[model samples]
Target: MIKTLDSVSNHEHRQIIEKTGYKVETLRIWKTGILKHSISNPSNEQLETFAMNVDAVLEKSNLHIDSKNEIRANCTSHFLNERRRTSKQGKETKENIKVVNNIKKKIRDNNLTVVKADKGSCMVILDRNLYINKVEEFMNENGFVKLDNNPTSRLINKVKNFRVSKEFEDKFGKYKNLIPSNPKIPKLYGLPKLHMDNIPIRPIVSLINTPVYKISKFLSDKLKDLTEFKPTYSIKNSGQLAESLKNLQIRRVLN
Candidate 1:
């Protein structure tokens, strides 16, 4: 019985059962383990009937046996792997949705301008005046004197000069600010090490000409009529941007 089954393939088994008078649902149930028996466990008479039916079907279809076997094997492996990948992605997507929802809630509650949230990080847009005001308020509440003569102007200047600094020392480094020992007064000041250009208060017009930006803009334009979609701030490349747009469409359709 094992040798007889060893000669047959899954597609052949399906075709044989399909050719018989039994419904395709029965064959499907058997394949899904709902049925206690499989096509391989058929009686001798059933096997004979299956064989005759498969032969007739194959003859009518004029399918090459070798080609059929090769194609079936390749497709089976390809589809099975695809199924597994899709299942794994579905689980990851569910987790990501939860995270994104939480982030959105926080943003709403805090009135923060968070543009997007994905796997590792989120993108936020800050208003310069609002941030400066908050800093000034904190400084006033803490009784910290501004380093320069003009508090608001000096605070803005410091923020403008703030640079991305890396540290290499545990105690003291170039980026570390020095405080006077036994100081007569507490002072609020910007770091001396930060000497970079001010953060852009407006959009960089030059970026519109870049390939990545163009691609993202094109996709957004194309999908404008279908749904409202925009690229997330964290998207670095055209492919990632496109995927975000695609997800937007899927979400709209699902909703």
Candidate 2:
């Protein structure tokens, strides 16, 4: 439904237009210029990530969250088993086994980068170099070197317990990006809102880290609405206090 595309911004937009047979014509008007990002896919991963990032900010408004134990239980009964069982339903039992084997193959192919102990409270993966840097930065900023305890101590206990009352999925209900670079960003419909996002450091070196904020659909949708093109311009021009708070929070987490 878009007409002449204006000056488009970002690589994803350009990629979409290129792949989708959309054309763009950039024009300058007076002293100002306008952009028109036209596309057939209309949806993008970066936009999804942005919505998630903004939603984390909105979740702070609720001042409620779940504890670590509840988060772990929800992760087990809901996420892990549910995915396995759901995959088994639509396909032959052997096909489901094949799917699970492929997943295992992927895990093993990565040199078993992630390893876990059943009884241990912490999940440890092979350390990646780049992730080390980010984690170090996070530590320098927050005076903490470990993420294992942070989830249980800092955030898990701080938030109130919530349940997966209903099934949830992403905006398009298509799993575009299941993992994130920022752990604080909320999952689509998963419980234990807070998680450890990873960064690749090297062939095997990666840093696993956590986010300070935990978010849900209510916050995600609100942030999406608030961050559409109009709100961004308004925030840039008039939202000094809000911007400062945002900067502060980012600094607190990332340093």
User: Which pairs of residues collide in model 1?
Assistant: none
10 residues in a row with least lDDT, candidate 2: 187-196
* Candidate 1 Cα outliers beyond 4 Å, as residue runs: 1-63, 115-200, 203-255
lDDT string for model 2 (1-255, tens) is 121112112212111111112112211110122223222221346545655665566465553455544544554465446556645553544443554455346445554333221222222333233334544554466564434543433443343332332344534332223222345522211111012223211122222333333244445666778776355444454477576577564434554
CA shift at 225, candidate 1, in angstroms?
A: 29
lDDT of 1 by residue, 1-255 (tens): 011112223223222211113234333432343223212223447645755665666567757888666655665576567657766766655555555565445445545441211111212223334435544655567676635553544443443455544553342343213221222222332211111223112211243322234334544665785686555557768997788677574435553
Candidate 1 CA-lDDT value: 0.40
Q: Give the number of the best model, judged by TM-score.
A: 1
The C-alpha lDDT values of all candidates are: 0.40, 0.36
Total clashing pairs in model 1: 0
lDDT of 2: 0.36
